[model samples]
Target chain A: MEKEISDPTLTVSGQRGPASHERRIQIIKSAHEHFLQYGYKKTSVADLAKAIGVSSAYIYRFFESKQAIGEAICSVVLGKFVVALHELASSDMSASNRLRKLYITLLDMSLEMFFNERKLHDITIAAVEERWCTTTQYHQTKYEVITKIIQDGRASGEFERKTPLDEVVMAIVETLYPFSHPILLQHPILLEQSEPEVLHQRAIAVSNLVLRSLAP
Target chain B: MEKEISDPTLTVSGQRGPASHERRIQIIKSAHEHFLQYGYKKTSVADLAKAIGVSSAYIYRFFESKQAIGEAICSVVLGKFVVALHELASSDMSASNRLRKLYITLLDMSLEMFFNERKLHDITIAAVEERWCTTTQYHQTKYEVITKIIQDGRASGEFERKTPLDEVVMAIVETLYPFSHPILLQHPILLEQSEPEVLHQRAIAVSNLVLRSLAP
Candidate 1:
């Protein structure tokens, strides 16, 4: 087994200067593009380094290996997903309305990622299957965040208390996970329909079903 | 692409007698074992032939290639699933009772397939991703069988009329698909716990939720 290490250059501390931050973002964006086009199995460190105009040794300074970089990309995407849900949690809307908005936002984000950021989805799936510990912890954190929001809704008398918060959160995540991952939608059977309008309607329908189930 | 030809040997026509039927079933069983051990990508025609105590040329006499054998295995499994649902549809139980039984049956069948017939699950996942036109048609046929059961319930006043049959079908299939497929369960994250009992209970809970929503 290879030792995996996290990227040190891309700090979340918000202490990096603008130039450093911009450079880091540039490398990440380049890597993301390469991974999406070629997939994790085919993408090489040298390829990514060449694309980013850096030596392979210098690329290693930021990430330990291709797998580490892929994990970082997944972390970035999942972090963004958590932030979006948090934003929804902070809103002053009814529980059902917040959930409705959350679903729509998630579906749109997924479509954008599917069309433009497919590599991230592949990395995430690999992380889930291969890097189970990290992926499970990440899911636990996200589940906690969503569970807290549901609990808050119950406290505010905006949602029912009948359903278990954990179950509801898991169900919601399970229902939306397919739409969030491009590999799933990439199925030819699912892609048979060309109308974006119809696909959007299907997402809305699924969202509505979840909301109705959670309704007080 | 190689010329696509349907397996005349697998057809239910009178051309294949009892002995041929028995041989086809034996081939599927042997191929299933090979798939479980090596996955769809790694499993070869020669491997299956060796496992079945036959020459590679003899294997090809019945099926075109390794992929065609996989298709045959999937068809056998799916055919059994269709038969189970058809029997459930004709039962005279109340809607809620029938739904409960259906959920339990699916969970049990999925577990059985996941543990005992892992190769079939592996091939099915490959079939889904490869979008072999035959696999897609097989899925559609399975969906149609389930849809007709739901439709029968609706017409017989056994189920509520307002439920979205397609969405319900998708949700049920999606939820059970991974649980049924051994490859997905082989992930360490899923293997960490006793899943069969918990999953069976969850299936019941989800079915109840759907039935409550659909009840008139």
Candidate 2:
């Protein structure tokens, strides 16, 4: 189900007392870890507050609820993805080369997120499934960042002009999203004997298909 | 978590007594529904047992545990996928026409499975992630079916001799796999407002790319 965050008005840039901002960041980071470890259903707001050494009220003071905390976590991760793609687009590499790099980088980031922060990944999957905080400005901003990269590539004749940039971005996003969610990637029977190399090879093969499609 | 089924020996063939076989099929169907409704973690063996009007032990009598049930569920779904692909391959159509039909059929089948059999899709994602049942007889059977199609197309001079059939099959499977998993496609903030037409267009575009790569 899509989690609903009550305080859609909250912003990372909103004016706050220095101490309050610091505490909020602490709570968010702690909550991220807790959510990653126990998942959204199992990790309570109180658990996050306790982990951050703050009162539940303090957490509320910064955010509204567990769902709000989840939005923040997803925003942080997706924000990272956008920023990296933007950097790749701006680099001196050719459009096709840059796109390939972006694909590989995105895959690596997803794998890292899956292995390192499984709880947050789980929370993100829940958020995505439930359509939680999807209408929020934060998500729109991230989408724009991705769209801009494709637009830039097209404008510079780096990508095929006929291809729909927005659709390509969405497909790539959909393709890479599962690898970030450990719960989606963990196959019990396959895990018994499948080496990491095998999984990595599969990721590379998928990336190649996406990259091939995006090439000019 | 890797769901461990107790007796990995009970195959899905209508082998156990007729009553037992019918009961097993019913349990799998109920379990599939539960998986779709609550996901893998939230759907317990007890929940499945209750839904199927059987005791947990009765459920276990046919399969071993929740994980074993998951394996059976995925095997059933994937088995269907392989069968569909084989049918497409064996049809008396031109190679290019067969490829096109194969793409469209797979896409429709996958989307149907994703939306209708949510539980089976969830179990498959878990199976893929955990690397469980990777080298299973089912996958081998699937590979052979796909390879046969490519080999037939190649011998008929319908596809480029340089095209790697194994790689192409892998690409098709991997690309479609992500879309079949709801957790990847159902991002609330990122995809909640996303139009289905956009997704359809993206699928068509990617299929075209795959086809172009195989063209002689």
Candidate 3:
């Protein structure tokens, strides 16, 4: 509740005719920046509004609470991840290669945020636990991406068709839990290797296990 | 808290020579029953002593708090799961068969708890989130069982050595997460089938995916 930040109009003074939707995006971005800087539990709505040079009341028009902002941040991050997986899945690489790359990317992104970007990772974990609508959509889309890859793999005669495609895709993600799951990754027994190379090797091994499990 | 329940001598009136440790075991069993009969959050220390015909103070002599009793109950349940896994892992069945049976048992037990024993399922979830020490130990022991099975799989020429055996074991558990995880079992997408037979088929499908992944 900074006195100086109480004026949303003044904050937008430099712009000639900023639309309400554009301002909402600006608010979301500013809140996301605050999250990355201050961590999830510590970042207050007032802090986010002050950082954006807007009044807390002004920010309230856009978001209901800090939890809303946090969900938006996670949606953005996970959206980007799903987009990356879709891109790789749609590429010209062999279906098997695409699936492997998809998991490698997944493992890398999750681990990077977890180990290097601790604040952001904590926020993401909170969002996940809350199971926001966006998180559900992200999982749904992720399932489709894996499903598409399996469909392609089946068409190419690369993967065995012994199980239903949906089940196989689900099993692949579920089995690779140790390599990509952030919470499970935190367990000392699953994560003795701190070196990125060692961990990457583990991810690769896991990806290979998935690939081989589906081989024709 | 009841005056008469605190009378330890009266609680064990007929016992000529009761060891303190043995009494502790009896207290754990009584608390476990109360937990099953009345969910963890509702089951109080006084209620436990009342059920056991002992004083609340006497219950404290054998246990620290209600949380400790809850944890002990979880420990006993998870210990049984680990033992079941170990027995299958050590049996004369082929390592592939053993692994498949292991996951089948896991999925069945988890789903059974979720669907048939709602109170116990809630208690399990609480203990999991609480990260009880025994839960940690259970995970450690479960990992060993998977590792042993993987080793036997390799020895039996059923699995290849593409990944470190440790990583492979972790991958198998991670990948089969949906079929075996209680929380995931509650998801509509994963548990569309209410019939145990249908769910068992899904577990088998997942188990085969893992088995195929490790095939030479």
TM-score of each predicted structure versus truth: 0.73, 0.70, 0.67
lDDT of 2 by residue, B147-207 (tens): 6666767888876676455667776666654444344453333333555566566666556
Second chain of candidate 2: TM-score? Answer: 0.71
The CAPRI class of candidate 3 is acceptable
**Which is the leading candidate under lDDT?**
3
Pick by DockQ: which candidate is best?
A: 2
Interface RMSD of 3: 4.4
Q: Please, what are the lDDT tens digits per residue for candidate 1 over residues B1-216?
A: 122222322232111234357776788787777777777778788878888899998777677777777777676775566567656655676556666677677667767776676555557666666555555554554465456556666776766667577876655444444344334453335544547777765665566555544544
Q: Per-residue lDDT for A1-216 in model 1, tens only?
A: 111222222322212234346665676788888887888777888989988899988777666677766766676766666667666766777666776777677767766666666555567666655653445554554565567667777877766788776667766665554455334554334545425566666666666666556657
CA RMSD of each candidate after superposition: 7.8, 7.8, 11.1
Q: Where does candidate 1 clash, by residue pair?
A: none
The 10 consecutive residues of candidate 2 chain B with the worst lDDT sum are B1-10
lDDT by residue (A96-171, candidate 2, tens digit) is 5665565467557766665566556556656655666542443554355456556666777655666566657766
| lDDT digits (tens) for residues A1-216 of candidate 3 | 001111111111111223448888888787777777887888788888888898998877767788877776666677666677667767888888988787678878877667666667667656556556666666666677788788888888988877777778766656555556555554333344346677676667668777878888
